[model samples]
Structures are given as C-alpha cells and as structure tokens.
Target: MKKNMDDVRFWPGNIVVAEAAVAAGCNFFGGYPITPSSEVAAHMALLLPKVGGHFIQMEDEMAAMGTVIGASLAGAKSLTATSGPGFSLKLENLGFGYIVEAPCVVVNVMRGGPSTGLPTQPAQADVMQARWGTHGDHPTIALTPAFHQEIYMETIRAFNLAEQFRMPVILLLDEVLGHLSEGVIPPKPGSFEIINRTKTTASPEDYVPYDTSEGDVPPFAPYFAGYRWHTTGLNHDRTGFPTTDPDTVTFDEKRLMRKVTGNRELIDKVEYFQADDAEIGIFAFGSTARAAMVAVKQARAKGIKAGLMRPLTIWPFPNNQVLAFSKQVKTIIVPEMNLGQIVYEVERSVHSDMPIHRINRVGGVPINPSEILAGIEEAA
Candidate 1:
C-alpha cells in the first residue's frame, strides 16, 4: 500500500500511542480523562468507533478499569489510559485482571504525584507503582519508551505481550513523552505484529479455564462463547472454581507468578548504548533516557568513557543484564525524573561493591542532560 503524506507526519506521543493501540487490533477502550493521558482517551474515543470498535468514557478510573477487564473477557482487545491519581483508583480492578488472567493493556501517562502532586507536569515517580501498585503477589510486565516514535511502537508491543501472557500489560509514559511531539513514520498496515489470546479447543463440559497442562499460561476462551467458566479474584482451581485447599492455593499463586518470571528471557529487554567500552555506565528509563543519552555523548566528548543502559521492559527488572554491565563499569550513575526508584534495582543487581550514584529530581521537571553529564563525570 502506498503511504499517504499525512501518514508519516509528526504526532504527539499520546496520540501515537492511541493510534498504535488501534493498529495492534485493540477494539475496546474504556478510560477516564486525566492530564497528559487525556489525549490518548480522546483519540481513542474518536477513532475506535470509526474502525468498528467500542470506546467508553467511564465515570471514574475504577469503572474504566472494570470495563476493560469485562471487554477483554468478552473477546475484545481492550485498553485504558490514565495518570497517577487515576492510576491509583484502578488498582483493585487491576488486581482482578491479574487473578482472572484477563488480556488487556493499561497505559499510564505518569504525572507528578503521591496525591496529585503535579497534575500537568511530568515525573517518573510511578515506576514502582506500575510494578507493585496492585495488591497481591502477581507478576507484572511493563514497557517504557524514550521518544515519541518509541511510545508508538511500545504501545503495540504492550498489547501483544498482554495477549500472549493473558494478563494486563503497562505502557509507562511520563508527561514529557506523553505530550511531546515528533515526526513519526507510521508502520505500514499489517507490517507490525499483533497477538490475540489463545482460545481453548476442548469441549465445553471438559474445558477448564485455568488449566495449565499447556504451560504456565492456560488457554483462554472468551466469556459466553460456549465455554462457561467461573473467574473471580479469589484463589481458584484449574476448573476456575473457588478453592481453599493449601496445595491448590499455592499452585495457583505460583502459576500466576511463573508465567512471567519463568519466561523472563523472552520478556526482558534493554537497550545498551556505547556500553561495550565504558568506564562509567548510566542507568535510566522512560523519558529520562533521552537526557541520559545526551549526557553519554557529552561525557565521551570530555574524554570520559561513559555509556547508558536503558531498560525497555522495567518489570522483571533486567537483573542479569545489570549484573553483567556492572562488572564492566567502574561506577554506575542513575538519573531519573523521580527521587530514585530504579536506582534501587541497580544497587540490588550489582554483586560486586561498586559505587552507584543517584541523580534524582522530583519537582516535575526532568533531569537535564547537563545534570546527568555531571553525575557521569563525578562517577568517572
């Protein structure tokens, strides 16, 4: 198909995320409007129906999350978008999505906050929240991108991972990336990958919704599709019936966790820039990585060996890679828009006692490239 001029134009990161979700076969979007993330909801509201999909602006973030989970259960690829305060509201339903193993996407365009700290400003404070905001011990898969184009691509990848794993996946963006605009050449139709949830092939009477003989992940049959199965937040058996047996509870919890932990090799991803021969390494993610990259270049120009290790997949925390990189660098510097979330991960990953410097900023402004460069130079 020939590309139209309009198709390769610049777009804000949030808008691109919405478009990418649509291209990834998402047919349902249920979310409430929130700063930095509202554009995503608005775009979906306008575009989803045009493509024969469903879009709902719910009364609150909790309802928005519930709607998406229900839609996913009904065989529609669903998504929701929100910021910090709204994200907190969706935690309960997010936990429900986890236990039920519903396949859906949740985009959190992060804003400063413990309680609406800076609604319209950017911050990476929610990094830890994206991993542990929901209750219980379920596994999580989250992807962060640095630029507008990456935001577009990662949104599609988030949906694919959610479907492939039969769980909710998070695309973590901050105000900077969410509202930033840049020219992006949209992927050609059908050129990108799209994954749908696996369907059970067993007879209705024999179907077990949580059956795991296939692997840690069970085949999922859409609700009301001749596969009558029970699903609840309560611990359940392979038949999806509520259970109180210790062994069943233990096995169910492990299954929920292992589907992600056991498959870490397939899900973990990182981007290493100039790290092969660096004396100093900078660790960053999301939009913070953009400035980190620039800082790496500045350090190089100043005759200092510096590089960057940016996590594309934040959860499942990239431990092995961080450990390996730690061995190669004399010191590590972590610069984030928050007062230090991922720095703790880096500290835990380094087996050898290496000096780890934390350069944090939580006042809604991003850590500048100069600040990162200074940290790198000091570490060197």
Candidate 2:
C-alpha cells in the first residue's frame, strides 16, 4: 500500500474524492439527489457494495439526514450530501448530531439559495449558513474545495476532522467544483490517514456520556456493545442525563463550544495566493474562488496588483489570515454566485473603509470572470 503523492494519476476529482472516502473506510453514505453533489451520491451507490459499505438514496433531504444520524449512532463512519435547500433541511438533524457528538461528514454542494435560490448555479452564499444555520452553541468544521481535485482530498480531510473533534464536518462544494471534470490522482486505498470515532471505556456500569475534564469532549462509546448510554437534545450532565443546575449547563455549553470554536488554529484553513504587496485582492470560496483566481491573474497581467484569498475552511472563516491581507489591500473583492452573502462577513471583519465590493451572479450560472474583474477594479 506504499505510494507517493507524486505518483498519483489524474482522475475526475469527485470520483477520486468518493473512492478516497471509500478507501478511508467511510462505510455509510445517505444522501438525496441534488445537482453537483449527486455525483458523490451516485458514486457511493455504485461503489459501496463492492467494498462492503452501505449507500442509501433517501426519498428526501430529511430522510437523508435521518439515515445519516442513525448510522452514525451505530458507530459507522456515515455522511450525507446535499446542496442549499437540502443543507437547510438537515439543520435540525445537524444540531442533533452536534449535541450527541456523532462523528460524520455533511457535504454541501452549495447552489444559489434562500429557497431553491438557483439550483444549478454555484454560490458561497451558504458560507454563513454553514456557520449559523444549525441551532445553538455547537461547533462546526467546514472545508471549501475550489477545484475538482481538492474535492477528493478535502472530503477525506473533512472525515478526519469530524472524527478528531467528534463533530459534524462539512465539505462545502459548489456546482463548479462538483461538476467540473478534472484529473485527480487519488491515493491508493488505505494510503491516506483515517480517523475513527472515539469509543468509551468507563464500562456500562460507570458510563457518563457527557462527562469531561477541561475540554469536556467525553469519550464516545459505540452503541449496543453491552454499553448503556443515552443521547438527548436536552442540556445534560456527565452521564448524559438532563440537568437543571445552571452551573452544570453553563460548563457543558462552554466545553462543547471550546472543543471546536476555541481551537480555531487547529481548524482554520486557507490558500493565500500571491498577496505580497497586492493592492487589489479578491476573496472567495468554493467554485467562485476558481473564477476569482482567473480574474486575479488577468488583472495581474494588466498591471493591476491583484491576488486571491481562497479559503479551504469556510466555517472557521480563516479570519486571522484573511484579515491580515485585508489590512494592506486597497480593495478586497468577494465574488459568489449569489446576490450577496459573504461580503457581509468580510465587511464586518475589516477595519478600514477601503471599498469591499461584491460581484455576484445567480440563475443557474457561475460568476463570469469579466464581471469579477470589473468588481475588483471598481474596488481598487
């Protein structure tokens, strides 16, 4: 099983991503049919049985999540793939997954959205949605893939992060990356790192599902191995029992929050491309970032100093890294396939009054490079 990354052959990124997940021991996939993301589901459907894994195409988004959470509880590395609307539908279940500390991946092939916003269009609009859509003080791990090849690699990373944090990890995609045909050299089966969900060791008689030390990420024991544990949405105690003590709830909430939010350095991911003394920079994510990259180079060719800030991890925002570039640039342009979404977060983080322009396109088409280049100049 020894292989080098340099020796990897090219493949369609989604297929490589899917097969990598299979190779990483992702035994279960429950997803609904949605554009861009449907390939992941289709790939899983065909390949899972060959490797003795499970794949279920649910009747709807809700069912997809239901199956995902159910499978996760049984100690299977499980996940569900969907776009905007379907991602929205899975929020409640996402919350359930969070509180229960179930490790699974949620691949959101982001399409334009508020309500079926633009089914075929690419959007980073879900950037905020990925952060706040799910209820309460839970943490998130979201990775954005700008190209077909990274989609395969990042999906495996998402699973590793989920298992590491014992939280739901999101693979944020757009129509562009999901559907883009590109070559990827997938790692051989068992070649890439794999992380499994943590199991409990307190014994059934002394099990405390919510127990924790400083970090409070309780050791997670799998279900039905003669280990009795309870999981509920209600605020609970070390043993996973409902608690009314304000102090206990307060401690539990903070612990849950710290496990992910406090460890931003561990989760923050970004691609800072050519930001050395750049006057005009474009900030973008997912498929829109791909278009921005093209525009940035074209602008660079025209004697305008331009570059791209592409974030691999969207939810944690990589704000520290992004804002550092924002301070020096005269313009920080954000382009997406939605009317306006990520621009707000950028605006909120940057202190200077330098114009933060947004270039957006919706109605089933990706953002044109020309439009984004125009936006970059306008901001510049």
Candidate 3:
C-alpha cells in the first residue's frame, strides 16, 4: 500500500483523515485506541514521525486530550481521535481547551450509545453530545463528512477552523464512514489554503494572552515562544488570569461566544441536492446524508419533488441556511441514525406550520436508501 501523498488510492475514511491531518500540518497526535477510531491513531503514529512530529498513545482518553492541548499551546497543530465513551472522557479537558483557547481537533468516530452500546456499529446519537459534552457556556465547531473524499477535505478544514477560531473543533465520524473504503484523490499540497494560528507580535513584556483590544479573537503567542501568560480553567480576564469580578467575568464569557457566533458566515457550510425546486426537503448529515442523497434521487424518479440539505458544519447548526431551505419546501424530512436529535433543530428553524417528519434509527444498522426513500415517499 505504498503511495505518495497526492496519489489516488482506495483508502478507508480513517486513513484519509490521518493523511489529511498530516497535509494540514498536524505535528502532534495523542490518542488512545478506541473501537471504530483506532485506525486514525494507528496511521497518525506512522505519519507523524515522518514529518518530524510527535505521536503518543496516552494512558486514557482524558490524558490523551490533555496532551494534545499541551502540544497546541506549545505551537503545534495537534489532534486526537476516539469514539463515544472515550469522547465523554475527553470533555473535561475539552472544556479546558475551550477556556484557554487551545486550537486542536478532536475526531469522534461515533458508535452506538448511552454507554458502550456498540463498538463496531454506527450511530448518530452523539450529534447533541458533541455540542453540549463539555459543561458551561462555550462555542462549538463540529464537521460531518459523508464520503471518503469529503472525510479527507473536511479533516483538513477541521484543523483550519480550529486554528482560525482558536478553539477545539470536533470531527464527528460515524462507524460506517470511518471504515468505508472508496477511491480518493487527495488534493496536492499547496493546492488549498492551509491556515495556522495567528501568533502575537507583541513583545513578552507587553503580551496579554487574552487581550481583546485588537478584536474579539486575540492573537495567541505559543508557550515557550518568549511569551508568558496564565492558562486556567476558571473564567479569566484579558490578562488570562482568574477573575471573579461580575463585569469582567460577564465580558469574558460573552467574548468567548462572540468569537465564533459573530463570524458565523465564515464558519458555517452545507451542501444542497436538487433543492431549488423542492416540495420536500431531507435534512441529514454525516453517513446518513449518503443514504439521504440516494433516496432523493430515487424519489425524483417517482416524480416526487424531493431535495436534500446536507450540513458539513453541525455545531453552529447552520440555522439561517436551514431556515431559508425550510421556507422553500412544503415539508421537511429529518433522517438521522439517532432517534430525532437534529429533528428538533429543524423544527426550530422552520417556524411556519409546515409539517416536519423524521426517520429515526437507533439500531446498529444504517438507514439504507430504500428506507429513506420510503420515508420521503410517505412525507410526499
């Protein structure tokens, strides 16, 4: 399986993700082997050393997340991969990454579950968890890619967004897509823009880690880069030191959220299929979107004016785009591997009396094209 970076190959989604991260300049990977996501760590172990980067198999999920955060602070584009239970363990440290503005990516190859429900099976049950897994108020950025090629591109974009937004970005991969193999021609280096964190030019004496004077997102000077600033889990002020003052805390929290929410247009993305003249819209993402796309075509064959709205960015939820798409269709069908997680978001976006239907599946099995087409047919 020897191949160059740009060479086209039939690769599994996890392998493509690892290669894309390498191309995106991910210099550090710290993760533990977890079901449905071990290939990502396995490949990273092989790739990082070739690029003079570091890869560590941590003791557990929490330690793995902490290591990536440390690497990011020390000026490396870092990442970690895991599944549902492991993703849960990473949340506390993930919360730390959020408050300290560590730019790194967390890949959750989702499987069945509230607990360790299914190790090798697929599920979209973690959609809501990815958004609210960490405690307290914070901004979230999560991406869902439906195919092998998309998984490659989106993996790079995940790192880009993490660096651009100065926060931890989540890449949600279901078990089906994580293991799915297909032909992928990864973009050659320098073909696409690769963004790194904005480093501060301020002198060490003048540097403030959380300084918002320039803008909502302050430039971050990496640790050991002749810059000194406090990093903490507690709410902090512009100096990055812990703060208890009501106004300072209020301002700090709002600023954190504003960095992402204020720049929604730049962070949000979606894909549309035959939606321009649709009477029925299918709202789906991740591997489920793959089935939804096929179902859309099948419905059209039956003269059903059906369309699909596949969101690549899931966290910020793409509310405005969903709202606009909802307006054009008389009814919206929400299909997900989980039991109606995203359906609620669809309902919220479409304030009109338009009927919103759902095709929910929680079994380890994927919703096939026929099942989704049947759902669309029923809605039509």
Highest lDDT scorer: 3
Clashes of each: 0, 4, 0
Q: How accurate is candidate 3 locally (lDDT)?
A: 0.92
Enumerate residue pairs that collide in model 3.
none
- Model 3, span 1-380: residue lDDT tens: 45555677888889989999999999999999999999999999999999999999999999999999999999999999999999999999999999999999999999997889999999999999999989999999999999888898999999999999899999999999999888889888999889998889899999989888888878989888788878899998888889899999999889889988998988899999989899999999999998998999999999999999999999899888988998898889999999889899989988788899989898799999999999888888
Instruction: Give model 1's TM-score versus the native structure.
Output: 0.97
Task: Write the residue-wise lDDT of candidate 1 on 232-323 in tens digits.
Answer: 88999988889999999999899889989988887898998998899899899988899999999999999999999999999989999999
lDDT, each prediction: 0.91, 0.79, 0.92
Q: Give candidate 1 misplaced runs (Cα > 4 Å).
A: 1-7
Q: After superposition, how far is residue 10 of candidate 2 from its true place, in Å?
A: 6.6
| Residue pair clashes in candidate 1 | none
After best superposition, candidate 3 residue 112: deviation in angstroms?
Answer: 0.6
Residue 100 of model 2 has an lDDT of 81
Error of 2 at 142 (Å): 1.2
